[model samples]
Target: MKNFKNKVAAITGAGSGMGRELAIQLAEQGCHLALSDVNESGLAETVRIVKNRNNSVIITNQKLDVADRSAVFQWASQAAKDHGKVNLIFNNAGIAFGSTIEGFEEKDFKRVIDINFWGVVHGTQAFLPYLKTSGEGHVINTSSVFGIIAVPGTSAYNASKFAVRGFTETLRQELDVMKCGVSATSVHPGGIQTAIAKSSQINESLKSLGLDPSHAKDKMAAQFITTPKKAASMILKGVRKNSRRVLIGPDAGFADLMQRIFPGAYQVLVGKLLLRRMR
Candidate 1:
C-alpha cells in the first residue's frame, strides 16, 4: 500500500471516469493492472491511454458485469492468479437511476440497486480473500454526495449509494477490530463528469420538475464536478494514508459536514428550498 510501485490493482468499471483515471495513475507508478468494464471500447480506450504513458506495466482487460455474483467471484479468483497479489480493488462501477417511489418500475429499480449497491458488495466480498492474501491491500468503494442526503429525483440511486456508504463504514470498523491488514475507504464524490446522468432512467416526477433533460444534463456537466483524474489521485492518496473517509469535492465536503453537524437542519433546509419554487 505504501509503495504502489510494482503492486497490482484490480479495478471494476475501468472503462471510464475515475476507474480509467486510477489505471493511468497506478500505471504511471509502474503498478500492474487488471481492468474490467462492460463496455469493450471504453475498456480498450483506458488500456490504450495507460499504455501510451507506460507500456512496460502489465495490463489485463476483462469484460465484466459486477452484479453477476458468479462472474464477479470467478473474475476475482482468476485476477488474483493472473496478476499475483492484487494489492487494490477499486469497487468503482456504478449507475444512476432517478425515479419517484410510485413511478419507478421494478426493473429500473433493480438495475440501479444491483449495479450501484450490490455491485460493491459483490466486489468487496468476492475480492477480499485475494486482497487479504496480497498483504497491505486496500478496498475503495464509491458512494455519492447524495448518499449523505436523499436528493430529489434520485430516490433509487440515493438508496443504493446510501447503502454502500453504510456497508463500507461498518466493514471498516469490523476490519479494524479484527486487525485486518486491508483497510477500507468509502468515497463520497460530488458529481463528476461521467455518463451516469446521461444514462439515468428519470421518471415522471423528475420530468414534472420542469428540468429539461438536455439542459439539466448540461448544467450537471458544468456545475459540480471534480475531474476524474483528480478524484483518482485523491483516492490513491487516501489509500496510501489509510484514511477511512475520502471526500472528493467541495459539495461533498459541505454535505458531509452538514450531515454530521446538523443532520435534521440540512434535511429540512434542503426540503424547504426545493419546495419553495414548486409552491
Candidate 2:
C-alpha cells in the first residue's frame, strides 16, 4: 500500500534479520506490529525496539514456530483481534540446512521444509482471510537466490525457497483473478549478513562427500554482500509499489539474469564454482 500509517502489520520471524528491521521501520512509519519468533529474547528485543521508536506504535510479541500450521492460524486470528485489522503479513520465518540430497537425513530435510516452505504456506493461508477483510493487503514471502539457482550442498533449502517462489507467484495470480485487493510478493535475497549460515545444521557426512562444512560456512559469510537494514528498506519499497517479485541485492539480480539467459546450463557453471571452492 502507498501509505503505511496506522496500518496493522504482522511479521513472522520478527526477532532478527530483515524481519526485525522491517518491524522497526514500519513502526517509524506509524504501523502497528504483531511480531512473532521462536526466540523469546529476540522477539522481546524487537518489541522493545519498535516501542522505543518515536511513533506511538502498538506492539504484540509472541513466541511462535511458523511450522505449526494450526498455531499460525490461531496467531492470525489473535493478531486481527488485537490490532483490529491486518493489512500486511510478512511470512519471513525460514531456516536452512547444509546437506546434499544424499547426505541429508530424511528427518532433517523434512524439518527444513516444514519451517522454510510450509511456514510460508501456513502464514499465507492463515492470514489471507484477515487481509481480505482489511480491504487492501499484501503478503511478502522470503525466498532466496538459492530459489533461483541451486547449489551443490543446499538441496533442502533450495527446494523450500523454490517452492515459496512458485507458491507466492500463484497466490498473486489467484488474487488477481479473484479481484482481491490482497497481493503477494516473493522475495529473493542474495546473501545478506544474517545468522542463517552460522545457524545452519551441516550434514557431517558432507566431509566424506568431499565438501568441507566449515569452509562452506566461511564461504557463506564471505558472500553476504548486503546488510539486513538495506534489504528491509528495499522490501518495504517493493511493498509500496506492489512489486510481483522483489530481488534484494545485485547478486540476486545477476543470478536472475543468468538464469534467464543460461537456464539449465547454469547448473554446470555452478558446478564449476563448487569445484573451485573445493580446491
RMSD of 1: 2.0
Q: CA lDDT, every prediction?
A: 0.85, 0.90
Off by over 4 Å in 2: none
**Clash pairs, model 1 backbone:** none
lDDT for each residue of candidate 1 in 1-279, tens digit (9 for 90 to 100)? 676998999999999999999999999999999999998999999999999999999999999998899999988888888887788889999987655677788899899999999999999999888878876788899999888887666788889999999999998998898786888999988868777667655655556655554455544556556889889999899998889989888878888887889877897776565444433
Ten residues in sequence with the least summed lDDT for candidate 1: 270-279
In angstroms, the error of model 2 at 76 is 0.5
- Whose TM-score is greatest here? 2
Where is model 2 poorest over a 10-residue stretch in terms of lDDT? 270-279
Candidate 2, residue 213: the lDDT equals 78
